[model samples]
Target: MGDPIKKIELKDGTTRYRFVIDIGRDPATGKRRQLTKTYDTKKEARAEYAKVKHQTDEGMFVGPDKTTVSAWLDTWLKSTTVDVEKATAANYADALLPVRERLGGKRLQDVTEEDVDELVSWMLTSGRKRGGKVGSGLSVRSVQLTLGRFRSSLNVAMRRRLVVRNVAQYTQIPREARRKAAAMAALRVPWSETEVRQFLASIRGHRLHAPVLLALIGMRPAEVCGLRWSAVDLDAGTLSVELTRTLVEGEVEEKGPKSEKGKRKLPLPKPLHAALRAFKARQATEAIRAGELYERSGFVLVDELGVAWKTDRFRRAIHKLMEQAKVRKVRPYDARHACLTYLATSGVPDVIVSAWAGHADLSFTKRVYIHPNVEHLRQAADQLDELLG
Candidate 1:
């Protein structure tokens, strides 16, 4: 007969049966080895033992591993080839830090949905220490991103058969939390046309005027930063958006646009076109002055020394221009919102606006970009009244 099953009471007052089976001898040492398995009942133990014995007989059995969640996550991060961007990969690594700190020690097979829920809760309320001060809790979007990273990592683990299932997928943010996130998103109001004009006017002769104007013309900051002289056609009044500049792991890299929509050519607004012509003349003068010291990068936006502008430096310049213009400060990227709002309210067709803004879907352009001001709404109401009367 096989080894008799022994019953033991767990800390939770549940009895479980355990049994040992002689799997085989270690080929290297030529010594016999055994594996122990536990089950809730003698019948379950006997069934599992038979399955193990059958697998062993067929040379298909793999011994149990003590791999933990941290070990598996490390493996996944190093081995994954899922088309992730470099900056996005860095973000995933950062998101995994809290997850590893909380659940890293748990065995991969023992991770539960409740553990994921706890991680979400902690992310919602926890603060990070910076410059000897602890900031407020992470925003809902940030927490969601972190959880998304965890789910992606766990999916890899599941594929590798490290875990039976992705327990992180079972966790969800509460309704109240989602509502708060929505409310936060709703607070981002687009700048009015007058404010936009004032901002452009204030930065007229600024070194960064061209990039700032390009951003107002609906280019993302990265797109504007990546703009090349080769892509510009002043005579044709158009520029092609074929590449984007991004800061990845503290290094600037040039890559193609995020999507096909991002690769389209757009007509340059008259003011921006004139600005670019003037900027080109100014750059030519500088190039001549610097002589051998000049670095000819051919980027549309650059510093006084003719180096390409970094995103952070451009953001600071925007803030400074906002202060000089006496306009409410907004994120530099909000220039897109201003442009989109103007286009939407100007009675441009949704399809055309979507194309100009490089949005894959018109619905996204309508929902996210359109911000109808009171004046536009009043005019619309007046038109409706006239038709009704």
Candidate 2:
């Protein structure tokens, strides 16, 4: 009675829309029901209307509303019950918050594939700091992740009957090719025995020195920081990696080692063993004097205040040490790669090396090991012949 209903064909061949007359009683409220129903095509809309009219006569109808994509995303982010980790949720929120301007006003039900394409294209063409720098394009990787999250949000909306279709499902992101590493080694800067010595020489008497050396040997920073006195076996010349220290909101927090694989005993070289013994003696003397609980979590590493050292602070210290030593700066984690390369070229068995390093696969070790020096290869070949004989 208000206005005549009409069907409209969308540019996309697969769908059609219509504002149909509402004529049915609301099953729960006993009030009259009224609204629109969309269909796959114009022909299908007529069939759908016929079916809906019959259903309405018999009693079954629901109303649709004008919701925007950005509006629904906001609701989904705040209310969805997905079991995402804290760090992951923080990342999603950060990524989604800035894109509101791009999507906020667009009608969710009327969203087209072109809208998704244009938004992503604009993100990439725009700079790194989201409207900060003109020339710095967004990282392809971050853009890809943002798009994936968008798709996930849309999927939730579709499930709740908030959106008609998941338009983001069909969107695509262009790929960027891999880049090369500029380090001495592909993924590391394998310090020669001499370089290690020089590094130690520079950091002597420095608070973080011994732990840095221990890191170079094989232990991850977290594993080393988490080490407790109980985990140390001074006489046995080994250290048990039990806990890892992480920085949370600028404070050191101790947590169990990241994985079971991370909780292993590693034999310390003679120099490291001696250093730990010396470190213990010094720490014991200080603990007695300070009357403060000497952070006995036997961390092979700790800050000046006898508190656990954080991984990032430790990394920054390592870089500073590099600067002082005049060595090219390499990440502390690269020391793991350096150690693996040293073992591979030293004739250690691949399987044995894998277990020692807690690597899940031997192929991963092989792929990352440094290229052997020509002379070392010849030496290995000669040794192989002697062993074969």
Candidate 3:
């Protein structure tokens, strides 16, 4: 009754049908427009034609655009404000780089589940080229994180109506990768209290003593580096972890803690209190020697010239300190682990330990930092026996 379907015979003797529908006038040009679709059968073409005609009559027909994944991602990155932290934005950008390199050229609307699956597979097996050679494939955790970033950006495209679905949601990290990730997580080892005490004693009188002591007190490395004299009260014996210093993309940035719990005031231990007092007195003497050349940065930890320590410099110093200590070598971050482990073993309540460590959740502290020693388990069994008796 409407425009008749045009049937054509192919060279292979199969037949095909073409359907055309009057969509509407081009608003800008004030001219009539049509949508054309081809199908293998007249029935198929007619079905599609009816759907399109209904959509056109209802004024809900939206023409597909030529937007590519890369273009959409670029736009989304520029426009997105949610979940973007100053200290972590660079890491998010870095995560998106591989997505752009792999799928940027593909049309946003045309990105299929197969394409997303292929991207995940490639990330698992092949590594991004660094210099002239291809580096090792990304770790399972890295792949999972990268895919998560891609999914988040694709969600933006869906919200903008650029794509009907986010294909990335269907793709998953392979089973092998998951097993490897689990194994790696299980291998994380925290230092013992004895090792921590030995390390602190060895690093005594070192320039990094203040930072190392702060780390041993369960302050994050960033929080330790960002500590300022104004936030410390020797009389009250409290230190406030209000700000953190981070290096993102090789640039130093000072910002508040990542979560509300991170902005907490913790009691200063007696040893740490004495150390800070001595350190401040020594800094004052150095400030006088440097005179006008001394940089008046109010940071609690500073070099002899009074400049605050950067993250990289602090990492190198910690590594060297571990070697000099000749104790079981562990990362500076393990200092927090050591402190958390001691507290957990010494019968400290999970809530208090989590607050003192600035952890947003107690489960994370229990799962990661609370390594139960054999002796502690034996003591727990003894307590259970005494209770039953």
lDDT values of the candidates?
A: 0.83, 0.69, 0.83
> RMSD in angstroms, all models?
5.0, 7.2, 3.7
- Please give, for residues 1-389, the per-residue lDDT of candidate 1 as tens digits: 54667888999999999988877776448788799989988899989988888877976565655788788788788776368788777877877877888889988778899989988887777734341336556777777887988898888766555565789887898889899888987777878998888887788887667778899988999998899999999999999998888887789988998789879999988988988999998999999898888789999888656888878788888898889889999888888988988988888888989999998988988887788879779988999999999
lDDT of 2 by residue, 1-389 (tens): 44333656566744455756676555347986576666655676677777767655754332454777677777788775367544445678767653565787877777778888887787777736643675565656666778888889888876655555778898777543123112323445466656767878888777565677788777777777677778889989888777777665456667665457666788888878877888877777777766765554445566544776678878888898899988767778878767777787788898877767766667877876544655557887899999999
Q: What TM value does model 3 have?
A: 0.86
> Candidate 3 lDDT, tens digit per residue, 218-331?
898899989999999999999999988878777889999989999999999988898898899889999999999899899987898799988778878888888888876667
User: What's the TM-score of each model vs. the native?
Assistant: 0.83, 0.68, 0.86
In what order do the candidates fall by TM-score, top score first?
3, 1, 2
Q: Which ranking of candidates, highest lDDT first?
A: 1, 3, 2
Q: Candidate 3 at residue 88, lDDT?
A: 65
Using TM-score as the measure, name the better of candidate 2 and candidate 3.
Answer: 3
Clashing pairs in 1: none
In terms of lDDT, the poorest run of 10 residues in model 1 is: 127-136
